[model samples]
Target: SVPGPASKSIITGAINFPFPTLRLTLAQENLSQFHDLDDWGFQQELEENYGRVVKLTGFSGYIDRHLFVFDPVALHHILVKDQDVYEEMPKFLCLDLLVFGEESSLPWGTIIANIAKTMMPAFSTLNLRGVVPLFYEVAERLDFNSISCRTSLELIGRTGIGYSFDPMLPGQEQTDRYARALRGLFVTAFKLQLFIPLLPILMNYCPRRCMAQEGGKLDGSEEGKDIMSLLVKGNATADAGMHLADDELVACLSMILFAATDTTSSSMNRMIHLLALNPEVQHKLREEVLTAPEHLDYDKIDALPYLDGFVREILRLYPPVPVMFREAMSDITLPLSTPIIGSDGTIMHTIAVPKGTSIYVGLAAANHDKSIWGEDALEFKPDRWTKGKADSVETKLPGIYGNTMTFLGGGRSCIGFKFAQLEMKVVVCVLLRSFSFSKPDSGIRWRKTGIMPSPYVNDEPKLPIVVERLRA
Candidate 1:
């Protein structure tokens, strides 16, 4: 007998076109066993019952066949080996275009690669050191629960484009036109559920909530000698086809602001929450940070073993973006590390994914796969790093950092991953040195929307932590 459900099962060996489709009505016996609600839950359930790879069918009437992959070998194959065969889904890109315009995302792959290559040096550790004091200044006024969003804004402002947006600075009010517009834009765009295909048309008709036109003339304080300014200045000197249009420049600025703020903040919120829940770990981390050299530089921070492990563990356990969506550009066979019994009673070494199939790369699931990480896979143990954690896993998971699927891998990996890591390390070091964090109460919980996951209390996006100031 095959591994899948028996009622609508087909035999193996004779390759079928669409493979066996799991009906949603019978989802309880099939898909529901894995996950019916959220991405994290789905990945956990899938790995528990179906092992590495599972074929899902009948997804909200659009998709016919979708593959939920949790195996590290399969992830490596999909993300690294045959990446060209798969690309970002249209929905994600459409949302990007609606929000940031054609310049930043319309031709996402090539443009992003080019932009990242061009701007990589600006965000590198060497050039970013000058902003350390700015972080210290920001950390002095940090509100543990709400600091993530504001601190991230300041970091990106001072470093990314040489501007300052933190309310503490003179003429840098949070209610400033640009800041106000950006905040209003997020609230409005999210309200529209911008991922829907009709958003472009809807936004076009609804001028009040349209983010694409919200900037309204990027003159005065909004324009500066920052990254966007350089891009605009450089574009002015370049040939027509070689440069960005005015709208494109505005979108680039918006994209930078939108992408950096929430993700870094969300991560900060979660990491501190983890530290608070485990008081022993928090004390150990604080001691490490405080005992480090009086002047902590990029190299010194990077050298902290425990801190590195702690951050990596946080990303592994609770990646802000849990699942990555991809569409098969062509029919292809995905190589699997472990073979699975097909629904037809045949031993299958590879998965035959047809063209146009939606594939959800299970990031969190692969991070916690028992086969890769051993029995205590789901537990958050920072010590896992010291004990040959990477070596213990026979199969290599394709990711930019810590041999985990946190930052993803391949051509479309997170371009700002290094910047994000540095920003996080600096903030954690500063905050831990001055204060301690712990859970506010027993009722706090983490939840995920369609996009990213964040913490909540009483059904509101709030992370109230117990904080204590450390004295010299």
Candidate 2:
């Protein structure tokens, strides 16, 4: 944002600053193997690169801050001890500038904060309570071949538009189109899934795998009336008004649909694969889920401690958003219990963080820390989340997540986590009740995406899941 090239000045007197002298090279390196940050064994990389307790510094940015990649102790200092000093980049302008035009840019941090504050109510216990039945429909459809690709099409349509998108009654097709557009809009917002949002019309650049297409009446032609219709009307719900403008309104709603389906589908894929591989853990989780009272309501689902812990453990072992990005504001030196290094050959005994740095906090790595989580960090152990001895340390890692950084920490944690939890629980319950499943063979690997990790089943073993009915 500051004009000209960002200055990369080095400090002559380093010890007086917050960072102790840490080697710069220790932090920055060529990501030669070139997979993804999440797909690669980033925890192992961080551990080997910085020890369990070293600080890493590569890029410097807009503040007196540099990137601080440290263990939990040092991370606690920045996220908690020095909370105000760090925040999400107000706009994440670099991406906007690099990709979309300036008009496409948003004051994203403000938008994100607003989303959390306003939308969180929908994810509260009351609203989250309603998501279970909604999720049950997904599993049912999956089994019965009733679900077309756009599953959330029905859910957000009713919730957002105040009616079902089905138009056999009247104005049904129009409503459905709007709902479908929003769903597609959100799923493809990120750079990875650029199929729908950016590629307004399918051109040559579209990826072969991303060839999934839908025929709509037209995008943005809302004559038939939907949420966009009501949004066009003077009367929108207060929940809808949480957005700053109409564009914000559309984007946020799209985000909701995106959050709903993608997290569920991807996460379920991983959990299902894990269940197949570790039949024992799956049985344990299923047993816990089934133990819930006959009437499956919010309280009953929430009461199942093992189910909750098992889901938390799944998130811990495999966090959806592996890397989070933040930008520095000013020359604010953070107190790190450990040491860090900056890429400009600056030895940070205590890091004298330069401004304008984009900090990538490793969520998956932090979740799997051997030091804090003990040695079995890599294994999927729900007991650690529930019965294990982790009370004292749990409170300290409050980035607004349950116990670990599954949802992240700070004001910018996931607003939809409660809803996500509810969705996961309900689906897990229904699937477990319907069938006892396992991997057809060994050597299946679940690869990671930014949010939706890919479950590469080892053998095309028909996924030969044996299904049986459960009595009501």
Q: Pick the candidate with the highest lDDT.
A: 1
List, residue by residue over 13-76, the lDDT tens digit for candidate 2.
Answer: 1111212244243322322111232336544665556543333222332223334253565466
How does candidate 1 fare on TM-score?
Answer: 0.79
In angstroms, the error of model 1 at 86 is: 1.5
For each candidate in the order shown, give its overall lDDT on alpha carbons.
Answer: 0.65, 0.50
Off by over 4 Å in 1: 1-40, 59-63, 103-107, 143-145, 168-251, 386-391
Summarize candidate 1's per-residue lDDT along 1-472 as a digit string, tens digits.
2143322322221121221252333334334433322334555666788767877643332345667787777788788777767777875666666555532333466665555554454455655565566556665566344557667777776665556676555434365455445433443554455444555433332223222322322444454434444444555566655665545455556556767777777788888888889999988888898889755876777789888888877888788777888888899888878888887778888887789987879898888888888888888887777532553766678887777888888766776777677778888887887887767655676666435666667767677888888887
lDDT of 1 at 472: 71
Tell me the spans in candidate 2 whose CA falls farther than 4 Å from its real position.
Answer: 1-29, 34-39, 52-70, 73-106, 143-244, 293-295, 339-349, 387-395, 448-452, 457-472
Estimate TM-scores for all models.
0.79, 0.67
